[model samples]
Target chain A: DAGVTQSPTHLIKTRGQHVTLRCSPISGHKSVSWYQQVLGQGPQFIFQYYEKEERGRGNFPDRFSARQFPNYSSELNVNALLLGDSALYLCASSQGRTQYFGPGTRLLVL
Target chain B: GQQVMQIPQYQHVQEGEDFTTYCNSSTTLSNIQWYKQRPGGHPVFLIQLVKSGEVKKQKRLTFQFGEAKKNSSLHITATQTTDVGTYFCAGHGDNNDMRFGAGTRLTVKP
Candidate 1:
């Protein structure tokens, strides 16, 4: 089966611009979560969605938001991007406990 | 808020040496998951421990959950160059959200 997939492998944005990252969960998965991974650091949770509803959110600022679709795909939106937002955005899908992560969307704010 | 902390930010050992990383949570965890992220790669699930005092082994790696369910450890026996990467311990909190530690980066010298 195909694993979690993400779009726009790389992105370049400017400060104060808005960006959106997409994620397609694996088949048969209903839960999708977003995380941000900075260089030399572990991933930090951003948001989690299930059944098209918001389930959990991390300590990120209000500028970050996410939603899941009926098909279990997800999109993470960040507004007013900052240089600090330059990192890998990962999407993970899970049914129970184990989560499988996507290759991630690399975002750079210039 | 729940937080997970890892010790020994980095380790460098000979290819045949053993290495271990520790994870501690400020609150009891519903479950703990381990992941390995290669350089410039997304995190890949390694294993999950759900029960207190549980132990699981995968080839040269052994995982142990503390009796209190608030700490965990991952030990690699006879480390190989292939084991080089960041080892992250994610503690499940808030039902659907997982908090990841800063991670322990392992470097093996041939």
Candidate 2:
């Protein structure tokens, strides 16, 4: 089966702008999670959705929000983006403990 | 707050040498997972260990979950240039929340 997929492989935005990143889970997967990875750092969890409900959230600010669709696709939105938001936004899908990650959306905030 | 930490933030070894990275949790974990991310790439799942004192192997890679469920380790019998990447360990808490460590960056010289 195909792996998790993400959209807008690359994006550039200015501070204060808002941006949305999308993700499509692997076949038959029902949970999707979002993470942010700054250069040279490990991925930090952002949010997790299962069955279209918010299952978990990380230490990220309220400006970071996410939702899952009925089909298991997900979207991550960052409002009032700051230069600190420049990083690779990763999406993962899982059935239980094992998660598969997508290629990630690279965002650059200037 | 839950925290996961990895040791030897960086390692450089010759292709034929052995390498090992460790992950420790501030509290007992329900489960832990390992991932690898090559430079300029997103994370990819390597394995998940849900049972204490469990040891799993894949090729030359061996993963071990501590008997106390508070620590884990990944050891490569013989390093290869292709093994160069950042290795991360993620812990899952009671709420199914995931926390990732800082990761150990590996550099192999062939």
Candidate 3:
């Protein structure tokens, strides 16, 4: 079966702009989580959704938000982007407790 | 808030040498997960340790969970160039919120 898939392999945005990243979970998976990975650092959890409901959230600012759809697909939206927001955004899907990650969307803010 | 810290921010070893990375969490974890991320790539799950003091091995890699469930370790035996990457440990707390360590980047000289 195909693994998790993300859209818009990359993006370039300016400060104060908004961007949306999309993720499609693996088939039969009901949990999707979003993470932000800065250069030379591990991923930081942003939000997690299970069965189309908000399950958990991390210490990210209000500018970052995410939601899962009925089909288990997820979208991460960041508003008023700052240069600090430039990083890789990854989406992961879990069936039980183990998660499978996507290729991730690289975002750059100027 | 739960925090996960990894030691030895970076490691460089000659081929066939052994390497180990340690992870500690401020709070007891429900489970710990290991992931490998190649340069410019996304994280891929390696293994998950749910029970305290559990040990699991895969090929040249061995993973151990501490008896207190607040620390873990990943050891690579006879490191190969293929093992060059950043290894991350993520801790899941009782709320199911996951926090990832800064990661240990491994470089193997072939």
Candidate 4:
């Protein structure tokens, strides 16, 4: 079975612009979570959705938001992007407690 | 909010040497997970510990969870060049909110 998959392997955006990244969870998975990873740092949790419901949220700002679809796919959106927002966005899918990550979408903001 | 801290920030060891990384959380965790991320690549889940004082081993790697569920450790024995990468520890709290440590980057000298 294929692992978690993400779209737009890379992206470039300008300050004040908005961007959206997509993720498709593994088959039979009902939980999707979003994380942002800065250079030389580990990933920071953004949002987690289980069974299409917002189960948890992290310390991210209002500019970041995410949602899960019925099919367990997820989308992460960043508004009014800043240079600090440049990082790799990762999506993970979980069945119980163990999570599988995607290749991630590298976002560069100028 | 939960905080996970890892150290030492980086490690460099000769081939066949042993290496270890520690992770501590500000709050007790429901579970702790280990992941490895290669340079310019996404994270891959290694293992998860749900019970306190749990110990699991995979090949040359051993993972341990503290009795309090507030700390964890990952150790590699007789490391190889292929072990070069960042190791991250992620913790999940009672609400299922996850937090990741800054990661310990390992450089193996062949």
Which candidate number has the best lDDT?
1
| Candidates by DockQ, descending order | 4, 3, 2, 1
- Per-prediction TM-score to the true structure, in the order listed: 0.98, 0.98, 0.98, 0.97
- For residues B1-110, could you state the per-residue lDDT of candidate 2 as single tens digits? 88899998999999999999999999999888999999998888999999989999999999999999999999998899999999999998656678999999999999
Q: Write the per-residue lDDT of candidate 4 for residues B1-110, one digit (tens) a residue.
A: 67899999999999999999999999988889999999999999999998999999999999999999999999999999999999999998655677889999999999
Question: Model-by-model lDDT, in order?
Answer: 0.95, 0.94, 0.94, 0.94
Error of 4 at B104 (Å): 0.4
Worst 10 residues of 3 chain A by lDDT: A65-74
Query: What value does the lDDT take at residue A37 in candidate 4?
Result: 93
| DockQ for all candidate structures vs. native | 0.81, 0.82, 0.83, 0.84
lDDT of 2 at B49: 93
Q: What residue runs in model 4 are displaced by over 4 Å at the alpha carbon?
A: none
- Cα lDDT for residue B24, model 1? 97
lDDT of 4 by residue, A1-110 (tens): 99999999999999999999999999999999999999999998889999889998888899998888889899999999999999999999999989999999999999
Candidate with top DockQ is: 4
TM-score (2 decimals) of chain A in model 1: 0.98
Deviation in Å, model 1, residue A42 alpha carbon: 1.1
Candidate 2 lDDT, A14-46, residue by residue in tens: 999999999999999999999999998889989
